[model samples]
Target chain A: MEDPMPFGTALHDRVRDEHPDLDHLVRVATRSGTRIRRRRHAIATAVTASGVAAVAIGVAMLGGSDLRSGGEPDVAVQPTAPASHPVDQPPRTRAERAHARALRALQDAPVYVDSPDWRCDQPLDEKFICTHGAASVVVVWRPAETWADYQDPAKAGPETFISDVHGQFFATVNAGPDTTHAQVVEVGEALIWAE
Target chain B: MITDAGKDSEDFGDFVRATGTQLYRQALLLTGDHHLAEDLTQTTYAKVYASWRRVSRADNPVAYARTTLLNSFFSHRRLRRSGELPTDPTLGRESSAPEDDPETRLDLLAALTILPPRDRAVLVLRYWEDRSVADTARDLGMTETGVRTRSRRALQRLRPLLGAELTERTM
Candidate 1:
């Protein structure tokens, strides 16, 4: 037998070598592409509307503030989402390019849990790990997923409670060994949509 | 490529036209269901569309979209399942002709059908896509060691049916 023979040759021979009628697949994808266009339109509108709303809110806050008095505004509404990407480790491979994008998405995540007073960090690629005291919560933000409402509570496990803010993100709370179920629930309730 | 909105719109169509079929094929290999594959592909497209501005800036847009498709499979597969793995005859039969080793093919498909999602993903990325172990680990957000462990476990499950050389090496 050859040393270090190629891996999964049988699989490639079966799946790759074969030429099936895949024409229908293109048609299916094209037909479904319209839904994506609609979603794109809706998201664009939300983004624009949110932009306008932000400007208005910013203007209002600016007008009400006594900045002319040379003092900081009390009870300041946060201008930036607190989620950030502190992991500056450059990707080592081609696939890590996508991993890097996921890390960026975590920083741009719209929702954040404020009650537990957590600092969200990307210890992995896609998910954000937010820690408060002994507990840590996992937050995964799919910015483009503005229409998919598919939620799986079973995947939450006995230790975690999930805030499946459908179409935007999923937050898995109560992650650390010392975190309690109630702490997770509290975090879930305190989630703020910073969009 | 500093494209305006009109060009970006056209570019996305071209992007989908170019990559949709391959993505669908890959999804089929992963899910073993035509409908599920279509759903996975569409969802992937929609998600990718929403992130087009960022995705378009990727070094390799095709690979980025492919990674999106794999992640989409993991994210949404559980939502559409009926708490049972489908054993329908149409599970993995995209063959164009009768196989000389039809029994072996059947056994392999059967083994694949029973394989866990992450294991199957590791196998598909490593084998069907011909990605490196490092690439597969990066794509799946797993360490290289974790990918090897999963690959071994996955191959072990298929060993009874496939007796593949890769499984032999891992064993």
Candidate 2:
């Protein structure tokens, strides 16, 4: 059999010659038109306004999880390390406390994940905002000993909660009924669902 | 972030008018079907609109647009779960009949259909646009040698479909 023709300028010309309305195609592809843009802008504006109002009211109700329930325990930042001694010192700032909590959480958390699947497939239920059917690892934090050594039953965070969709990082923040707490999670490439 | 409406539209319009035809041809070759080509083109523009501020400032806006289009194509493929895109009119319009040899045109389209999207793009960029191997390499992010290799392989695959006469006459 004769060898297949090599694709080069000749082939390009042939395709071009056959299809003359090529510009229109690109135009059609890239042109979302003004209406779509306007709609997108309106939606974004509304969302921003709502977000501002939420901040003003000192409460942000993100989709999923009912943070307004009365029985919910207060979510507080955990300490970086287990207390060694009663060394009298200035109380840590909120930012300092959150950072220390993140560092300690990373260092001392005990998770029994052997594979990526085990890590990602941890159950998330109606009470906990997590993957219902999807797989994800869970990271839980215990509150500081001085305040109350409690893991708020209503609060859960996935310190390694990588999305199995857009690969965007999402740290769960459980701030009780009125305050906000967050977990720093890393977004991994596989979370993009390349497969 | 200068977001002047009139200035942006005019600049985007000029860019579209200048590069639209070339992009269409490239899209047509990549998808083989006209409607899919149009859909690809339109999506490309929407993306350009979304990032027009940064894109307009870049020295190689065309390159940015092309990459955007390619990424869009790949993304659609992932969503659709198949590389075999539809030729439905809802996607894009039918190709216009050109005053050329029908057999040659058919042969070319047939040959293009057999090649992978990237290979088709390489040929379109190389020949129709009259770009150097280096320029094609730069645009497609392939090494010069890789471009040459793909080009050779693409031609070799197209030769049999085009037949001996077409190859000799065209080459």
Candidate 3:
């Protein structure tokens, strides 16, 4: 302690001359901080992706619930339209009554769903489109082309079924995931043409 | 990949390489415990590295790192020594080396332990770091007058402890 300088200088000299384990400490600190930052960035990305997925699911659900009500078809079967066939002869065949019943069911069917489902649409003037849940049935008033079962590529479901009901009417049932083959046929058979 | 983040990390590592020794010495003066000083120095660098983008953009990154170390010391001053004293096993090895006045070193550490953390910080910045009254004030977030007063009072407190230690050594 000879010529012990002022306490401050002595203190500074004591620290300034000292050495510590620098390599290990600096390496650990830098690595730990960078790892934590990368973890936070990954978590943020995952949260953003999940948020987008949730919004898409919400929009899809809202679309289905939007048009769930049972309402009249876009085109009603006009009773006064010019008949293409003789009107006085009553259809006495068993198949004739079934076709008329199917047309009646079409007039009683509900409102339309949106693009995600088998959305009900009419491509012809005399055709009336109606929906039941995810399933749809299109009724043609006069003799028209018997359309075939067509797959809607965008949706995951069974193919649609189109069949001429009697001699003068065509019934097309769009089969959705919720509807089976027999269920779609039943939907086609639901149409009626009662006076 | 040399992305912005990668560059920031590289720059931070370089900064640590340049300033780590000086900062560790400053921590040693502040805490008077080799292992504790090492811990404090590592923690300070880690905080700076975490916000490397902002820290690198600062006018004086060394000053920024010093402030963070001081703040951490003030907040967690009683950081447990894991049931140990201010001295550590490493200093025993350090004391045997040449120019190691073990008794004088012990006296300094014992003297520092008498004062509270704020007074210790004032002494460290003023004496060890050779910071001006104004610079010490900014580092400790105190007024210049407060730095002067604390430095005066802290020295007044340390005098007798050091005197007693020297007398004990002479006997």
* Per-model C-alpha RMSD: 12.8, 19.0, 30.0
Candidate 2 docks at the CAPRI level of incorrect
lDDT of 2 by residue, A1-195 (tens): 542433344455555544435355334433454434554575466456545544433432321133445443243223222133111132366544433333322222221122222122111110112221222223322223312212343333322332222122222222222111221232122122111
Which candidate tops DockQ?
1
> Which candidate number would show the highest lDDT if scored against the true structure?
1
Fnat measured on candidate 2: 0.29
- Residue lDDT tens for model 3, A80-181: 212332122334665564443344233322211122223233222344444556544443354433332223433313444554444455545554334567
Q: With candidate 2 superimposed using the best TM-score fit, by how many Å does residue A31's alpha carbon deviate from the native?
A: 6.0
Candidate with maximal TM-score? 1
The DockQ for candidate 3, computed on C-alphas, is 0.15
lDDT on C-alpha atoms for all candidate structures: 0.59, 0.49, 0.58
Provide the lowest-lDDT 10-residue window in model 1 chain B. B89-98
Q: What is the TM-score of each candidate against the true structure?
A: 0.52, 0.47, 0.50
For candidate 1 chain A, the 10 contiguous residues with the lowest summed lDDT are: A79-88
The fnat of each candidate, in order, is: 0.19, 0.29, 0.40
By TM-score, the better pick of 1 and 3 is 1
